[model samples]
Each structure stands twice: as structure tokens, then as C-alpha cells.
Target chain A: MNAQYRHSQPGYLMILIGVILLVVAAFVWVYGLQPLEIILGAIGIFLLAFGYKLTVEIKNGFLRFWFGLGIFWKKIAIEQIVYCEPFRGVFAGWGIRFVWNGWLYNVSGMKAVTVVLKSGKKIHIGTDEPVQLIEAINSVLHGQVGVESTQMWSEVKADYLKRVEQALSVARHPRSFEILADVGNHLDRRFTELEPRQQTWENFQRIITEMGPPSEYAELVNEDKKSGRLKLTKLEMSAIGVLLVVFGVSAYFYPQMPERIVTQWGFHGQPSSYMPKPVGMFGTPVIFAVLVIALIVIPRTASVSVNIEGFRRFYGGLLIVFSIVMLAVQYQIILWNLGIKTNPNVVGIISVSAIIVWMAFRFYRARRHN
Target chain B: MNLENWQTQLRKGLLDIVVLNLLNRGPSHGYEMVQTMKRIDGLAIREGNIYPVLARLQTDGLVTSYSEPSTDGPPRKYFKLTEAGQKALEDMNKHWDQLISSLESIRKGTGL
Candidate 1:
């Protein structure tokens, strides 16, 4: 097939290196006769066969590339591409290998055109003509060619599109119009594919039935956008309140505490570790504060996508349980410091067992829901 | 739950993988995907429900869409699976196979 654009970059340096390696391997085999010659010869042959050149072509709505006579080839659809831009990165020395979040096809030089796909993966095609390659990709992305927008629809198709719009109206999403257009395009295509006799209102209704209820579309959009923003729920507020209460209790007992306070206990109800009064009394609260901040910030700043809203309740409950556990520990410490006998080991065991059981139950519930 | 409700829940969970498997054959438009899904006896899905699933898939970067001019009507939006989508489908299929085999063993009163 004729491509809209094509470019090839020769790997002169790679060929030179391969030849040198082959010559060295031959010398080693002839003189020293070491088994290491086999490894060197194999690598040399592999490089010469697959690293001689990189060819990139954009044709039939696909970005196709191959290295060294198409032994290793990859094809990406134009529709899958989000955007293409010039890549200016340090010379990492590549020969069809993976980069950060995608693959890099290069024969020589650091200059390349990176195409970011809708899947968030990227393809870096090393090319001497980066500008031309980018232009070719951008033209297709902007719908300048290959794919054209449709302006007209039949009356029957229009009604179907309107119903889809009406159904999706409940979503109130910013991308509603775009989604409507997508559905309209789909209906138009389906209408055209059906036999002329089967293009009646009855057939259209049947098609819509197969599509599912209109409200389902709204639900999907709403669910997909549920994690668009992070907000503190009532449970989270309560968890924070519990943490503050724990801190307040610690403060109440701070003056009565001894300079050295037991912070950790052994399995036999004996104190195993001790800390200064202030550190032992206030350390747990400070750590809890940091943990809370992290819980709030991580979902927002983490590089990977996560649906925090899906388990918002679980997270809030976890925080509350953790705070309560800390509070119990603080109470035990205060009592022990006040000359009241208490088994620190029992408290630790009970707290840990409760947490494990709660977590197991939560996981079971989550599995059932899924 | 009633059998119908149980079946509905099953279909909802399976919808994503089912659509991914269909697209694995080739790129197809929304209507074509819905129609093809209807061919499965117990897996008949509503036509409108497919769009939202497609929308979610596209948002997740698992699937992508492009428009093509049609001779009989307006342009058609066709969806194709991305590499990530293909990988996800493989994993889902593997899990599904394991689930089926485990269930079979349970029914036969073996592999307890």
C-alpha cells in the first residue's frame, strides 16, 4: 500500500560496530579458540541482521515501522495516537528498545519523533526528518486527511442520535457533546451497513435495544468521572476528630508522665523498648498526622492513575480504626506510667488481631462487590 | 438474588472483556460491536449500554476510535484495540479460564 509518508535512517555506526565485533570474534576463534567467540559472533550476526536501518511509514491510518529489512515490525493505528511531537532527549543509544513508557525505534542519533497514544504509551521513531514525520502525524490527528467528519444524517438516524443524546443528558459531563457525536457516527455507520429493507424504524428500535438502556450511558460517565476530584467525606472528618482526641488525651497525661516511658512491649508482657516522655507521648500523634497527610495527597500526586473514590469509605474506616488503635495504646501507656498495672503485650496483640480481622472482612466485602 | 438479576450482574462484569475480545478480531464500530455481542445466546446486551463501555475503554486508553467516510451515510466511528488493550484482554481471558476450571472442579466434587 502507498504510504502518506515514509522515512528511513541508515545505521552506519551500527554496521561498523557489527563488522568490528565479527572480525574480533573470528580472530578469537582462529587463535585462542575460546567459547567466548561463539557469544561474540552471535551478537555480531544479530546486530548486522536487525540493526542496519530503521524505516517508518504512515499509511492507511497506521504508523508502521521496521528495523533491518522488516525483521522486527510494529504498526500503530492513527486513531490510537493522541499526539506527536519532536523528542529532544539525551542520546541514550537505541536499537529498537523500550523507553520510559513506550518503545523506541532508533538506528542512530537522539533526535526522534515521539507519538503518544491514547493508551498513554509512546512510540519514539528516530528520524532525520523529525519535522516532516510530526507534520504527517498531526495532519491525520487533526482530521485533515484519512478520516473525515460527517455533516449529514438521515431522518431515521437523526432520531436515533437524538434519543442517545436524550439518554446521555443525565450525565451532564463536559464531554457530552463529543460523546453524542460519537454515538451519532456509530448509528450512521450501522444504518448504512444494514440492508435497505432493514433500515426501517422497527429495525432501528431493535438496534437501540441491543445498545442497552439510555440511563446506562449516564451511569458509565458518572462512574468514570467519580474520581475527578478528591473531597473529604464525613467519615474522614470523624477519623481526623478521633486523631485529635487521641492527641488531647496524650496532652492531658503529658505532665504526669515520667522522663522515661515504655513505648514497646515483648510477647511476655514485659517492656522491651523505652523512649523519652515527650517522644513516647506525642510521637504516635505526629506519625498519624503525617500518615493522614499522605493519605490525602498520594491519590492526587501519584504518577499512576488510581480510583480513590471507589474505596473512599474503606479508606476512611481504616483511618478511624488506626486512630482508635493508637488511642488505645496511648491510654495503656498513660495508665502504666501512672503506676496502674496493665499488660502492654495484651493490648498490642488485641490491636493487631483486630486490624487483621477488620482488614480481612473488608477485603472479603470488596471481593464480593467486585 | 433471582436468576435474572444474577445473570444481569454477570453480564455487567463480563461486558468489558467481551467487548475487548470482539475488537481483538478487527476494528469495529459501536453498532457492529453491539450486534455481534447479541449473537451470543446469554450475552445479549443493550445497544445503548455499549457506548458507555466504549467511552470508558477509550478513556482508559485500552481502546481508541477513528472516523471513516461511509458511502451510504455519515462517517463511521470505528474502535480499535491498543497494545495495552490487547494485553488486558489476555490477562482477563486467563483469569476467566481459571475461574471456569475452578468452578468445574467444584461441581465435580474434585480438587477440594
Candidate 2:
């Protein structure tokens, strides 16, 4: 098979479908699914997304090829990339990315595509629009070759050139006979030649390399091509995961806060009160445990991707800080609910004020004269 | 009519047409196709999201590519559809037609 194509499997769709499933899981959690049941459901989601594929591949050179069958996707030869740029805000910098020449390809949320030269310099481009990206990379690559405008072929035929021309014409809706006639003549000529038939066996492989559009997605397809074991990075996604282990220990023997430990040791006697929960022994602790998971994990779990304007950096920084603040707030709330000797309202006010100050500074920095 | 929104909708609906039309010309590359689409009046924000769809079509054996040394950087990929892709395009057109007729019928009957 030519390097131009990518195979998508039930595994690929598993990740996709996982998006909805995650939502379902959340709903189940919120609506009182048993904790064990919810945890099991989450495990199922992780398994499906990480199903039996263990390898992925990416070809580098003039055409980068990505292919795989398991956990490790194809290697995207760093040498092939030009540069990785971020879309800070204008685009859905978070989810989508585009290459400058205009071909959009999304590297994974954590990565972006760039073209690298033999000498090792990189330039940013997107995977979404391959045509423009190719042209841009071509311009950089073949600086000596004068650009030839490949006009849209206007005639209707089995060929794609004519179809583009027809679309262009339809788009323009040329209302005059002179323009229409000129277009008719323009569309008929063959734009480019397909290789002669005898070497089709050769062409098959050659064609894979030659077809630019689909190959644009070779890396992503390769990423989905296969994998069995989960990536360590993927496993660390939910803080709740790590927290679950802590939950058991915390439930079995509540971890003492430094202040409580001090009192317990008699350095500060009088048994400073710390209500672990209100009524049901497990109720307060469970809610506290869940809150800890939410505060420390959810924001960090967000998927990151580059956009035209440095969106990756922007989101990364914000998510980290957001998670920390949530942790602080959750801890405070849990403390207050337990009748700990602390004024949570004061802590809440301070946190809210800090967030405001942070936002103000961020706005100032974002809007400051560059 | 707000042109941007209209263009966005048109681009989404016609992306296949755009992709098909680009391929019909002769084999071009993915980047080349994207550039061509961007030049059209209403397309915007090409991302990783769209490529998977293209890959899906290719996996079904609709489109194909071959690499050629790029004058600038790495070898560039050129793309074209197989008979399967064209057939899929035709199928898409049929669905489009049914959708259009249904909408048109609704417009006539409701007069809203």
C-alpha cells in the first residue's frame, strides 16, 4: 500500500465515542451512580480508548508518513517539521489548528506539526488545510522554483481539476456569456498528467507518496493505527485516579492535618475540634475526597493543542493555576464542613479576590502595548 | 445577511464538494487542497478535526496519495480519489438533495 493512506479502526472511533461516554459518566456520577460503578465505568472508557493498538508510525522526509498498529504511534521525524505555532485566541486555539500555507492538520492536542529542513530549522504550519500548508512548505523548500498558479479546471468531467473550476465558477456565478465561454475552454485541458499505466505497481507506492492531501493526515492516522498498553501521560489524566488510592487510606485512617497533629501531640492541648463529617461517618469524608479529586484533577485533565497564536501555552498556564485555586477552595470547604476551627468565608473571599487580581493582571498583560 | 456566518455554514456543508473538486483536477496534495479551499469565499479554521474525516474516507479507499520531493522542505504529498471516493461523493449528493427537498417542503408548508 502507498504511504498516502491512513486506516481508521474501531479503536479510533472508541476515542471519539469516548467523548460522549465521558459526558455520560459525568451525568451518572452527578445523578448518584454508585461510586464503585462510576469508577468501573471510567475504567471501561479508558480501556476502549486504549484498545489493542500498540504502535503508530510517521514517515519523515519530503512526505511525512505516520502509521502504526499499537500503543506507540509512528515517529513523526522531527526533521520534517518546519515550525509549531500556536493560535492564542482567534481560532478555537484549544481544539483546532491550521498550517500557515492553509492546510490544517491537527497534531495531537499536546503537539503541533512543523516543517524541518535537513539543516534542522523548523517553521509552523497546520494539518487542517493541506493544500495551503503544502504550498507554504514548498515555497520555503523550493525557494528557487517560481510558483505556478494551478488554475481551477472549469469543465465538468471525471477529473478533479474541472470540478474545482466548476465549483469556483458556481461560487462566482459569472453572469456573462464571454466569461462563461472562456471558462468552458479553460476547463477542458488536462492540468497534470497521471503516470503511464505499465508502472502501476510502482505507481501504487509512488502514488502514496504523491498524493499530498491524505498524507497530510498520515501522522494522526498512524497515531490511531494501533496500541495496547496505555501511555503513562494518558494514565495520569485524572487527579481523581491518584486520589482514589488516597481515598481508601483517608477513609481507613483520616490523615491528620499538621494543626491537628500538633494538638494530638499535646503541643496545643484542649482538643481543637475537627469534625470529619456531620452525621454518616462516610458522608463527609467521601464528599471531601471527591472534592479533592475535582479540585486537583479536572482542570489538569484538559486536552491541549496548538493554534495559530500560541494557544497551547495560554491554556496550559491557565489550567495549571485554575487547578491549584480549586484545590485550595475545595480544601477550605471540606475543612469548614468538618467544623474545623477556620473561617472558610474569609478564605473564600480571599481566593475570589486573588482570582480577580490575577484576571486583571492577565488582561493588562494581554492588552499591554507590545 | 451576515456574510461570515453564511460563509461558515456554506464551507461546512460544501467541504466534500471542495475536496472532491480539488481532487478532480488531477492529483494535488492535502496542503494544496486546503489552500484552494481557503481561497474560496467562506472557509475558515482548518484543524486536526477535519483531517480525521478525510482519513476516514481514505480508509474506505476513496482517496489516495503519492509523495514527490518538495522543492522547499520535505517531499510533498499529492492526492486524488479512487472510484470509491467518487461514488461516495455521489451518495453524499443524494443525501444533500433529500435534505434540500425536505427543507424546501417545510418552508412552503409553514410559511414562517
Docking class of 2: incorrect
Interface RMSD for every prediction, one decimal?
A: 8.5, 18.0
Q: Which sections of candidate 1 miss by over 4 Å?
A: A1-175, A189-210, A226-370
Q: How much lDDT does candidate 2 score?
A: 0.39
lDDT by residue for model 1 (B1-112), tens: 4999899878988889999999999999877777787888988876667777787787677998887765445446789999999999999999999999999999998979
TM-score of each: 0.36, 0.26
Scored by DockQ, the top model is 1
* Candidate 1 CAPRI assessment class: incorrect
Please state the i-RMS of candidate 2: 18.0
lDDT of 2 at A176: 16
> What TM-score does chain B of candidate 2 reach?
0.69
Off by more than 4 A, model 2: A1-115, A118-370, B1-10, B45-50, B108-112
User: How well docked is model 1, in DockQ terms?
Assistant: 0.20
The predictions' CA RMSDs to the true structure, in order, are 21.1, 20.8
Residues A1-370, model 2: lDDT tens digits: 3332232223343455556666776766554433322434554465454532222222223333221223322234433443322322223221122222222223223223344332222333323343454454444443434223211111112132223223323222111111221222222111223222322334333332332222223322333231211122322344345345434543554433333321111112123233333222344345545555454344343222111123323333344444444444445434543557554344434545555565455434432311
